[model samples]
Target chain A: MNDTVLVLSIASAIVAGTPILLAALGEIITERSGVMNLGVEGMMLVGGVVGFWAGVNTGSLTLALFLGGMAGVALALVHAVLAVSLRVDQTVSGLSLVIVGGGLSAFLGSSGDPSLLQSPNGLDVNPLFPQSLRDLPAVGPIVFGHDIVVYLAMLATVGAAYFLYRTPSGLSLRAVGEDPAAADAAGLNVVRIRYLATAVGGLGAGVGGAYLTLAVLGTWQNGVTAGLGWIAVALVILAGWRPGLALLGAYVFGGLRGLSFTLQLAEVDVPSDFLAMIPFVAAFIVVVAVSANPKRARRVAAPAALAQPYSREAR
Target chain B: MSRISVEPRAHGGAHVHLGVPVASLAVALLVGAVILAVAGNSAFEAYRTMFDASLNGWTAFSRTLTLATPLILTGLAAAVAFRMKIYNIGGEGQLYLGAIVSSWLALALPADLPKPLMLLVFLVGGALAGAFWASLAAIPRAYLNADEIITTLMLNFIALSLMNYLIFGSMTFWRDPSRQVPGGKKIPESAQLPALSGRLHAGIIIAIVCAVVLWWVLRQTSWGFQLRTIGDSPAAARYAGMSVSLKVLSVLAISGALAGLAGAIEVSGVTKGLEPRSLATDIGFTGIIVAVIARTNPLGVVPVAVFLAAIATSGTALQGIGIQVEVVFLLQGLIFLSVTAGEFFVTNRVSLSRPASTSASGTSTPGSDTAPVVS
Candidate 1:
């Protein structure tokens, strides 16, 4: 590829990766606390619609993103009530959340004037750095030239890695995931921690979804996030639950997404449908490879208590 | 402060098992009604219209049955695997592969073949395709301990892409080149399933047969007992010298085969061609709702699939009343939520207990436990 195509690919990769990065980072926190919420897709959809609607009406990006995240929190709360409070099957509960989120979002989105839901001007975030920094050769557009969300995603990744490894609360969260019974015996509130972690994870997913509408696609459509939520879920496992690796994995997958478009621009004959399969196929192959080796898989295995509902009396 | 404590019950009995799903359905409707009212729609009118469209007349009931044909098979797909604690969410993808493969067989087979034999060939071909698709995930999950949930779901997206590619992107055998717009080539008329009623076809018979046979296998056969044992307690199954890996592979294959049957039925009985756009309806996902509501019982899947199919059949009619058809999805989700919460009650009992300190501060010991004995 020429320099222009290369630059375009790199720029697109960062944009595409941001949403997965944010969502995966959130999931890392939830998974670390031993609760697996598979409702990320549903959460993101709700977030995307709410963000798009709020952005259209109020013209405030911050409100849109905040409300989007809160919508996710609402869905996540349902998951918490079922999986954590009611001690039901977490897998089924999470799936229910997706259905509810998808249905609720679609219902709310389709109502009222169709014109009202469609923002004439899609949400946009201007690049943060100055002209000179963005004008530098090769590295300029790739590194310094992105909206505030990109920088925030990178910052969040660092913050997540540090919080997960450095602080006492993070240690408590890991303890709850690894052995909730032991954590409960050690005076930790297992149920409360799980609820908090799940909510936070929802918050991350919501923001990631908002990013999809407000930045990348910049408009609302039914099922707009289009399974990216699931990809983020898989990325968490692929990253071995590390924030830094999640960032790396997200961009690589994002690069694949970007390449699909870039290759088309170069007039390559590959079908778009085939291009779409690359990331999911990659996700499957890597997941299988990681899982096939018991020793390697064990090192990055999911939390021991993941998806297990913890009850103090039962334990 | 009073505290509510929950403990597992030794046995739930027939009432709890049956009552929970029924009550959960009622609760889901109540919630759906409240949401409709909040959204400025008449809940009663919407329900009345839905009831009229799906169940009031023989013709409407036939349509419901037509929709339920695929739901039953897909529901069984999920039910079978879920019974073994295997979350095979790839029913949607498996269903697609079944359609792709079965439709191919239908198009390629000689038109002169006998009707029953032709039908059997394509139907089994579809099931085999689905089983093979499911095995992709099952092998990794069974042998490598990979997470089937992720693998299966990812395969779903890949499968969808492949189907789209066959009809829309490439000049493949599946595509009808004569059509200006992209579409699948229609199957031979001889391969088509005969209509039993309005839009209902012989596919319903196939679906019902599969469900009954699956019920018998799961309930009466030694293989079924072994599978159930593995599901309930894998450690015990292993201790009993059962081949856990082989069972995992076989069980998932069976699950996929059921979903595949649903896809094939949809092709031969309903759409009569590989209509990718129309087929994208969340039948596979809806089947998950059916399986869960049925509590993963193969027999239970039949009635549950019909009930949900009734709601789905009323979608376009509901839209005539200004309510979006997506409300069906909302109701489905609510039902699933309530059912899952209801499951908690089936296995556990919760009771509120007052603190001992309120009545007797000095006489009662502060740290004495008030835990109830379970079982």
Candidate 2:
């Protein structure tokens, strides 16, 4: 392949994979706290629409990204109240939360008039940092030539890995998820930990949604996020609940999807539609493949109290 | 707000169903009315407009009836699968398979065949196709204990993409070339489902009959008992010598067959030709809501299906009134959330005892410990 084609493939793959990576990382945290929020898709859709409108109106990409993250957190708040506070069925409540977010997103989206907006490339062409580094071929421009936000996103992945495993709060969070009753007896605030984890998870989901509208496609369309949110959910399962590996899983799935477009360009002659089904097909395959490793399977950290609603027992 | 208990008025020994289903439905409509009021639309006027558009004249009436037909079958499909604790979200896929098979059957039939016989072939052929399609996930779920929710959901997309490939890419038999819209060939005249009145067809009758038959099988037969037993408690069912794997497979197959039957009926009775967007109809998805609202009861599927059908039919009316087509989606979403939340009331009650609030029944969330005794 030509250098130009290779550069484009990497760039596109990063853009495509960024959302899933962000979402799966967020989910890893949420699940680590023993709460499985299935409303990721809904949260992402809300983020996409809200961020699209905010970016255009404020004429500030930064504000748009911030607002998108807030929107996701806002939706997550309702889920927290229902599943965490009210102690409702996690599956039903999460699904219902999806319904609410989806409906609200679509309705609010209708008023914004999606096509009447333009996306600003939130990037700078400056070659200031280490002149020698800029001169070192495509390993520089394609990867390092990206915007400041991409760098922040990558840093966030590392932060998440550390936050989940290295820190005391992370340990406490894991303890709660593993055994909420034990955590409660140990004097840990299980409810507060869950709420914080969920909100953070939603924030991650929002960033992912904004990445789709602002960086990748640069335009809005109805249901454009498609099933990417769901793919992220499946990614967590594929990652076996490790934040560090989730990044790799995201790129792998993202690369397969990106290659579908490249194959079309190369005239590989396979039905493009069939190739599009690769990620989902890959998701199922990965899940089945991972089933053989008992350690990995057992390591899948779902909070002991993940799906169950918590209502303290009376004395 | 004044607090009132949901207590029985009578004191004598009695057995009367509290009609949670009917009350919950009423609450949904009431909330819908309130939403319309908030949206600057007159609730009463909107209802009248909807009634007029969907059921005022014969044309409108038939449209309503036609819409409800597939919904009934799909609702039943969801009920059957959910009864086994298997959430078969791939109803859309099963529906597509049904349409594909029924369409092919229509094509292969002789021009001289009677309408009744052709209809039977289409229906049975559709059911078998649906069952066969559902097995894709059922096998893996039963054997591997794979998450049914994810597998079934992904399979829906696979099914749609598969059909799209067939009509748009490969399968020559189902393609209707003359049609600008990408769709399958129209069923021959002899194979078409006959109309009952205006545009309502015999498919409605067939769906209703099947629903009644299922209700009997579920409530009055040994097989139905077995399915529910497995559904309610798979471990206990296993201890009782029931084949859990077989039950899972059987329930999914039945669910798939019902969804497939809906697809066949739609093809023969309404569309007469399969198309890319035709199967994208919300019946499969909405049927889940219908099933939940009906509390997974077969007899309850009828009213819930019609109710969902009402909201769907009224969606076009909202479009005509300077509202986005997404309004229908919004209402649909609300229905889903409301029904899911409503199930909480039916199954579990929260009661908090304090100095001011003392009750032996359901109450608020801040309760300490009020789980009811089995005795």
Candidate 3:
């Protein structure tokens, strides 16, 4: 209830939501091109482990982030082969990818020195707003006092919104998801668009993984991502195939997540376990409920090829 | 006839139809080899050591069978649900429920009951319990048109926590009273499944029989016909007068039942009782890969289960050779990817021959289907 607590809560929410927002945006692009990369979690797992190990061993923060993104794209290429070229069931291929990712990440992190790499200090990354600006309003402190990734995450959302809704290629990508056969017939390079979009999606998801390790935990652990990948998947459902709306949903979920920690600190009566499960529970309830509403369903633009394998014979 | 008219022209671009799944396996194996070399062991010797530990002796072979039993059932669980175009991603959770129920039945029943009767009840009770648990997802899916993927997945975590809560928090049904280990009470000797060989148990035979029956049901029966129809095309199935809601529920229930049966057999046979930590074993998700590699065919589950079981048994064995168990874990993941991709070889091929197919590149959009003929 205090002003300080409220300010901190809002700040934490933005930070926590960064990963989900990044992943959702990437998934939006991939799905827009009629490819559902279920391996976001796997991509994240590989990214998290590889990035953490590489960064800590080399001690170059930038290299860590780069390796993390490449790790994601590397995993994405496997998905591209199965879901795109071979035209296997997108969902099956993706889920399988997650198993591979999770298992591999777990194996690599099971050993190795824990203290090899240090968490990057935010002092340099944080902005020094004039105390005068800090006094301006509640907005200044809550919005400006943060690390660099938080700002970039928001910028990426804006970029995704523009790319998905405003651009010509975006329209073509959406058209592919809506009807790949029709897109193909219309002279659209369906496979090319899907490949690039999926790879880009991987890049975004990888950044999310880096945010998790370098910003959130500052340490590597097996199964560190846990089920956050599923949360990202649920975010897509909640967003209803719209990238702009995903940002809002991620923030809301992130707020609930932050609130759970606050309640724990305050020693609130509610069990923290139940509270922590809120985002997933909320995602399930919101997506199913929204989809149930005829109005909401009509407004939401789910790609026709969300989970289906693309086959010329089927077409 | 003597001079073959002209050899049919193969598509120029059709050099390989095998996809990423296949490629990833090679990549994974290469990565594993690198890890092995890094670990100060010869990759070839380490693999040979793993095979020796897993498949060289009867003890290991029997252990593999014991492990394969549950995997086959879980794979069947995934395959059954998939045939109806449903994603029952919560097989892990469902298995937990079945294990809890079976353990409860083993403990509470009249201590004098015959073993065969007890086994039958245990199997049915566990399966029905799993079916009941799965119905939670199926009903929402049928009535609310909910995405089963999220619900089922969330339910798995819930199930895990619920089992932990019962044993670790409240209720004394299965919790061990004295032991410091995170475990549960042992099931009665009368309730336990009898082992058949060195380590193999009747669960293996039961799993095999179940696979055959499942294959028959899916391939030859009217229900199977209906299921395949719906899986291939929901719209067409609806027009054919099939009750979509009922079909979805039935398939998911059957799927849940098989998974539940797996839990029951494990509790009654090798595990001898359920434990708080038992749910963490990943027979469920691994089964999903098995089902996929087999292309959702029940009969194909046997080999897939055995191979995965061998890999699992050897995971610990790798530690004996100065390699981390994680290496085996990585290999399993890679194999899942490869097996999933290998399915293409058993089903379809790609050809880039006709201009019409290439026309897809020019259009920049998909061609609309005015009318699609039902195969």
Candidate 4:
């Protein structure tokens, strides 16, 4: 590939990976607090449409992003109420959120004016650096050409890694996830921590969805997030619940996706459908491979009480 | 202030209670109505229209049945695996694989063959294909201890892409070359399932028969007993000398076969060929809801599937009246969420009591002090 093509692909990959990275980071935090939220896809859809709707109506990008995150938080709150407060099965709760979110988004999106929903000029985030910096050599385009969200995603990854390992509150969060009873005994407020972590995760997922709508696609479509939310969920396992690794995994998957577009552009003879299957197939293979070895699986396994509800009275 | 607490019922709460399901449905409908009102629509009128369109006449009822036909099979598929505590979420994929295989058989078989023989071939071939696809996930889940939920969900995507590739890419084999739009060729008329009346095919009867057969097997057979035993407690089943891994594989295979049969029925009976869009509908996922609402009972699945199908049929009708069809999904989601929450109530009892010690601050979390005792 030519240098320009390579540079463009790398830049596109970074852009594509940003949303996934944000969502994964959110999920990692939620999982660290011992709550499994599988409704990321549903939340993302809600966020995507809500962000687009807000953006079109208000013409304020900041308000759209904020509302998009709130949309996600609203759905995640249902998950929290069911999984944490009511002690329902976490998987079922998450799945319900997916169903509700998907249906609601479709309903809302369809009811809106088609013209308003379509962005003739897609929403674009302001770039972090000047055009002059972006016009430099190969490194300039890869590093300085992207929007502010890209940099924010990178910063969030580093912040998450630091918070999880170095902070006292982070230690308490991990303790609650690993053993809620012990955490409760330690006066860490287990239920509160779980609720907060889950909500935070939802906020991240919502922002991720907004990023897709406002920065990536710049338009609203039903099920626009597609299976990217699910991919983010799997990315959590691939990253071994580490925020830093999640960034790497997201970029890799994003590159695979970007490669498909590049290959199509170059008129590669392979079927586009087969190329579309690469990321999903890769995720499946990785998950199966990791889970096949008992010792290795345990090494990077989910929290001990990941899906179990914590109730002091029950014990 | 009054405090509420829930305790698990004794003797496994085996007795059936009609009130629980009724209450759950009522709650869901009430919530849906509130949502409709908030959206600036008349909830009562919309629901009345929905019911009228789905059940007002024999033709509408038959349409509902036609939709329910595949759901019954897919519901059974989910019920079977769920009974064995295996989360087989790949019914959609398995259904696709079934359709693909059955369609291939319909094309490859000589047109001169007897109709009955061709029909049998389609059914068997489709079921086997579904079973084969299911086994792909079951092997890793049973032996490698891989999470079946993730594996099955992933397989659904791959299977969908493969189906699309076949119909959209391979022109000579699956695709109709003459057609501009991407779709597979129609199955031969001789191999098509016989129609009963007005878009209703013989597949409904097959679905009913399968449900009865599954109910009988689950209730009366040793295999069913072992399966339920494993589902309730795999560790205990293993202690009883049952091969847990083998049972898991067999259960998933059976589950996959049923989903596949649904696919074949859709092809030969409903669509008459594989169109990628028609084949990948939410029937498979909806089947999950059916199984859950039916409490995983094969016989129970019939009524639940029909109820959902009626809603789906009405959804299409609603679309004609300028209401988005997605409202049906919204209602379904509400029903699913409420039903799952209601399961907790069915197996447990709640009571209102006062706290022994009054706190001046009144800052304690609700339900934190209420103890639940396993009956």
Candidate 5:
């Protein structure tokens, strides 16, 4: 491949991977706190559309990103109320959220001014580094040619890793996930901690959605996330609920995704449709491989009370 | 000091109230109305248009029935598996495989064969193909202890991609070359299901029969009892000598087969072949909503399927009048959310209670398993 093509492919992979990385990191925090919010896809969609709408109206990228994150938070709040407060089945709540978010986004995106769906200039984030640095040989394109979100995603990964492993609050979060009753006995305020974790997770997912609209596509469309959120969920499992590992998993999947487009661009004989199946198929394989040994699966990761509703009186 | 608490109803004493689901539906519709208003559309007129378009006339009603045909079978598919605590979310994928298999069978069969026999082959072939496809996920779930949710969901994408590959890319055996846009070859005329009414084919009968059979099997048969026992408590069922693994595999197979049947029926009865875009709608996903709203009761799936189908048909009709069809989805989502929330109230009773001793804060035992019933 030509240097320009290689540079573009690598750049595209980073851009594609950023959203998944952001969403997966949020899910890791949520799962680490013993709450399984499966509505990441729905949350992302709401974020994407709301963020896009904000961008079109306000013409401010920062406000668009903020609204996108808030949209995710709003959707997550519904999940928190249903799964956390009402003690509804986590799976059911998450699935419902997906339906709601997808439907709402589709309705809003299609019914409004047709022009808004096609943002003229697209929501491209300004590159973090100067043009001179970005144009510097092979190293520049790979390292300096990306927007601010890519950098933030890297920082978030490291920050999340430290927060999860090296901090006292992280220990308390793990304790609540492992044994809420014990955590409660230890004066951890289990409910409050869980609620906060879910909210923070929502914020991360929202930012991911904003990144999709403002950084990647720069336009709004119904189902624009295109199951990226679902892939993010699988990425979390593949990462074993560790934020840093999630970054790695996201990029790998992102590379595979980018490869599909790159191969199509290269006029490869393989069907692009079949190639498109790579990320999902890979996710399925990883999940099956990780879970093949039930004992090992239990021992390795997966928060014990991950989907279990917590009520002080339930036990 | 006062506190609020909830408790599960005593076994066998829980009253099955019709009010809960009804109230949930009412609330959902109210929410939909609010959404419509927010979108600058007349909520009442939109709903009226939907009802009139789908239910006002005999022809319109038949169209709704046609839409409900696949939903009924798919709903049964989800219902049966959910009863066994097996999450078979791969109905969409299974349906696609069923369509492909049934279409292949119909094409391969002698063109001069008797119509009834050809139809029978299509039905059986479709169900078997679906079962086979479901087994791919079921085996891993049963043996490897892999999470079925991820497996089933991932398989859905694979199945859809496989269908696309067959018609659009690799396999040209099923593709209709004459068409500008790629689509599967039409099934033999003999294999096509006869319409009982305007575009409402014999598949409706098959769907109803399956629902009844599933309901009977789940309620009266020993296998059904075993499945239910396992669903309620796997450890207890295992202690009672039930093969948990075997049951898991069988349940998923049955679930997949039912969903596959929906795909087959759609191909044979509705579309007469596959047009990938038309074939891959939200029917399978909607089946999940129907099953849930029906409370995983096979018999109850019939009405739920028709109700959802009516909404879908009406949504399409509204699209003709310049309204977006996504409102249907919004409503469906609202219904699902409200119904699930309603389930909490139905299963558990909540009430406020005052403490015997006056204190600034109520001393209520939270998360206590055997807290005294305040009533």
Candidate 6:
């Protein structure tokens, strides 16, 4: 590939990867707190629709993204009520959230300006760096030729890693996930921490969803997030619950997505439809390889209390 | 101080089984009504139309059964796998493979083939294809301890892409080249399932039979006992010398076959061709909802599937009354949520008590398995 093509691919990869990155970062925290929220897709859908609605009405990108995150938080609160408060099965609860979110978003988005479904580009985020910075040498476009969401995603990754590994509350959160009974005994409020983590995770997912409509696709459409939310859930497992690895994994998957377009552009022998399967297939292979070995699987296994609802009385 | 204490119940009585599901349906409708009211639609008017459209007439009920046919099989698939704590969410993909294979067999087999034989071939072919698709994830899960949740989900996407390629992108065997717009070749007339009533086909009978057979196996056979044993406690099953890995492979295969059968039935019963747009809907996911409301019981799956399908069948009618069709999805979600919450009542007994002393906090004997401290 030519240098410009490679640079453009890299930039696009960052853009495609940003949403997944943000969602995964949120999930890492949520999962670290020993709660698995499978409603990321649903959360994202709600986020995207709300964000698009806010952007259309107010014309403020920041408000759109913020409302999107709050929408996700709203869904996550329902999840908390079911999975944490009522102590229902977390997986089932998460699935229901997806259904509710999808239905709610679809209903809400159905009545909006009919023309928005055509994927217009008016809502797109502008690049943070000036054209001069983007026009510099080979590294210029690759590094600085991106929108603000891309930069924020990178910042979020660093923030996630630091919060997870450095902060005292982070340690408490990890402790809760690893051993909720012990965490409870240690005076950590397991329920409260889980609720907070799940909400934070929802916030991230909501922003990721908003980012898709606001920056990536630049329009509101039903099921626009597609399976990116599920991909984020898988990326969390593939990254072994680490923030840095999630960034790497998301970009790699995004790069594969970018390569498909590049290959189609170059008129490769393969069908475009088949090329679209690359990221999913790659995910399957890598996840299988990681989980194939019992030792490795155990090494990178989910937090011990991952999906188990905590009750002091039960212990 | 007053405190609410929750304790796990040893067993749920018969009332819990029958009442919870019925209660959940009512709760879902109530919640759905509230949502409609908030959305500025007349909840009662919309529901009245929904009830009349779905359950008021035999013709209407038949249409609901047509939608319920695939749901029954997929619900059984999910119910079986979920009972063993295996999340085979790829029923969507498995169903697709079933349709692909069954349609292929219909086209390749002799046109002069006997009707019953053709039907059997289609059904069996579809089941095998679904099992094959499921085995892709099942093998890794059984041997490597890979997470089937992710693998199965990934496979769903891959299966979708494969379907798109066959119908839209390539002039493969499944596509009809003669058509201006790309689509699946129509199956021979003899291959179509015989209709029992208005739009309802023999698939309903097949679905009910499978459910009955599954119920019998799970409740009676030694293999079923082993499977249940493994589901409840792997360590106990291991001590009893049961091969958990083998059961995993078989259970998932069985699950896949059921889902695939749904696909085959859909092709033979409704679409009569590999129509991507119609097939790409959320039937598989809806099956999960069916299984959940039924509490993963095979027999319960049938009625639950019908109930949900009734709502779905009325969705178009809902749109006629200025209600979005997505409200059906919203109702389903609400049902799932209420049912999940209702499980706490089934499994746990909660009571309110006041402390003897005037201390701010009420206390119970921690980790005590004794009787409830009623007050």
* CAPRI level of candidate 6: medium
Model 3: what is its DockQ? 0.40
Docking level of model 2: acceptable
Backbone clash pairs for candidate 1 read none
Q: List iRMS for all predictions.
A: 1.7, 2.5, 4.2, 1.9, 2.1, 2.2
Better of 1 and 3 by TM-score: 1
Best by TM-score: 1
* Candidate No. with top lDDT: 1
Best by DockQ: 1
The complex in candidate 1 yields a DockQ of 0.71
Which has the better TM-score: candidate 4, or candidate 6? 6
Candidate 4 lDDT over residue span A71-121, tens digit each: 999888889888887787787778778877888887777774563345554
List runs of model 1 lying over 4 Å from the truth: A1-3, A115-117, B1-5, B351-375
Candidate 1 residue-wise lDDT, A135-248, digit = tens = 888788898889998999999999998998999999999999999999988989887899999999999999999888878887777778878999999999999999999999
- lDDT winner between candidates 2 and 5: 5
Pitting candidate 1 against candidate 2, the one with the higher TM-score is 1
Per-residue error (Å), model 4, residue B126: 1.0
DockQ score of the complex predicted as candidate 5 = 0.64
lDDT of each: 0.89, 0.75, 0.77, 0.85, 0.85, 0.88
B210-324: candidate 1 lDDT, tens digit per residue: 8999999999988899988998899999999999999999999999998898899899988888989978788888899999999988889999999999999999999899998
| Clash count for each candidate, listed in order shown | 0, 4, 19, 0, 8, 0
Q: Report how far residue B143 has shifted in candidate 4, in Å.
A: 1.4
